[model samples]
Target: GPQIHRRTLLLTAYSGPVFFHILFYYCQAFIYGTTFQHTASQILAFTLITLHFAKRIFETIFVHVFYRLTVSFYSLYLYLFHYWLLSGVFMAYYIYYPGTCSSSISLLSSALETEETSLYFLSAVWIFAELSNFETHLILANLRIRYPRPIPKGYGFDLVSCPNYFFELLAWTVITLITRSLASLLFLIAAGLHMWRKAARKHEMYKKEFGSQYPKYRKVLIPYV
Candidate 1:
C-alpha cells in the first residue's frame, strides 16, 4: 500500500524555498545591477517568510508523525510545485517592489516614523498565531509519543478537529495583511481551501475511528466559526 516515503515528501517540499530564495537573491543583483537594495519592509518580509518555511522544515523533521501515512509521488510533486510558485511570486514581488504597498521602506525605517497602530496589531496577531500553531504541533507530537497511534487533542483541539490547520491559515492571513499583496492574498485563499478539505477528511476519519466518542462539538477546522 505504500507509494512514496513521507520524509521524501517533506524534505522535497521544504527544500524548495532554499532554492528559490537563493535564485532570487542572486537575480536581484544581476537584474538591478550592483545597487542591490534591501529595504526595511523587504527585510521584515524576508525574515518572516524565511522563518516560516524553516519552522515547517524543523517541525516536519522532528514533530510530525508521518511514518504511517503513505503519499503518492504525484502528491509530493504537487506540494513542491504549489509552494514554489507561491513563494517565488511573493518574495520576488515584495522584495523588489517595496514601495508598492503600505509605506516605503525608507519612511518606515523606524517605529517612531509612519506610526501605524494597525501594523503593530497585525504583527502581534501574526506572532500569536505562529506560537499557538507551534504549541499545537508540540501537543500533536506528544500524543504520538504516548500512544502507538495517537489521536491529536488539547489546545485548539477541544474546539476544532484541526487547530493546526486553522492557525496556519491565520498566520498566512496575517502575513498577507502585513504585505497587502494581492498575490499573497490569493495564495492564502488557495491554501485555505486545501486546509479546509484536509480538515474535513481528518474529521471524517476521526469519526470513523472513534465512533461517538469523538468530540461532538468540534468543528472541522475553525473554532466556533
Candidate 2:
C-alpha cells in the first residue's frame, strides 16, 4: 500500500510539470519562433522540472498520508529534498561543463551569447531563495515536531509561518529575471502574488488561533522585515 501510494503521488507531481512543458514548447514555437533544437532543449528542461516535482509530491503524500507524519516533518522533507536534488544536479552540471547549461535557444548558433551580469545576479538570488526556504522548513520541523513528542500546542501556532510562500515567490521572481521572457515573468508574478495572499491569510489564521503564544515575527513578504 505504501509503495502504491508513493507511485500515485509521484504521478500527481509529474503530471503538472509535463503539462507545463508541453504548453511551454507550443507557446515558444508559436511566440518566439524557436527552432527544432530550441524546442528540444525546452523539452529537456521540462524533464528536469518533472523529475523534481515528482520527488516532492511523492515525499509529501507518502510521509503525511501513509506514515501519518507531522505537517512540519513532511514539509521539511519535501522542501529540502527537492532543493537538494536540484542544487546537486545544477552544481554537478556547472562544475563539470562550465558553460554548457546556458540558454538552449543558442545551442545551434555559431556563436553563443555571452553571459550577462544580470544572469549571475539572478542565479545568486535563486540560490539564496532556495537556502532560505530550506532553512525555514528545517526550523518549522524542529519547532513543531522534533522538540517534544506530540505537543498539541505546537500545532496551534506556526514557527516562521508562511516562509514557504515567501521563498517560493522570491524564487519565481528570480526565475522571471533570469528567463527574461514576458510570458514567464507574468506567470511567476501572478502566481507569486496569489501565493502571497494565501500566506497572509495563513498568518492571520495563526494569529487568531494562538494570540500571544505565536512568535513575534515580522510579516513581510521576504525575511527582511
Best candidate according to lDDT: 1
Q: Can you give the lDDT of residue 99 in candidate 1?
A: 52
Candidate 2 lDDT over 82-174, as tens digits, reads 333333233222222322234633322323343444444555676677566555545455555453323222221234357766766777665
Error of 1 at 6 (Å): 1.2
TM of each candidate vs. truth? 0.83, 0.52
Model 2 / residue 26 / CA error / Å: 11
lDDT of 1 by residue, 65-140 (tens): 7547667767876887678777665545554552544463233335535535555666678788888999988887
Q: At residue 207, give the lDDT of candidate 1.
A: 89
Worst 10 residues of 1 by lDDT: 100-109
Candidate 2 accuracy as TM-score: 0.52
The root-mean-square deviation over C-alpha atoms between each candidate and the true structure, in angstroms, is 3.8, 10.5
Determine which window of 10 residues in candidate 2 has minimal summed lDDT: 91-100
lDDT of 2 at 197: 77
- Candidate 1, TM-score vs. the true structure? 0.83
Clashing pairs in 2: none
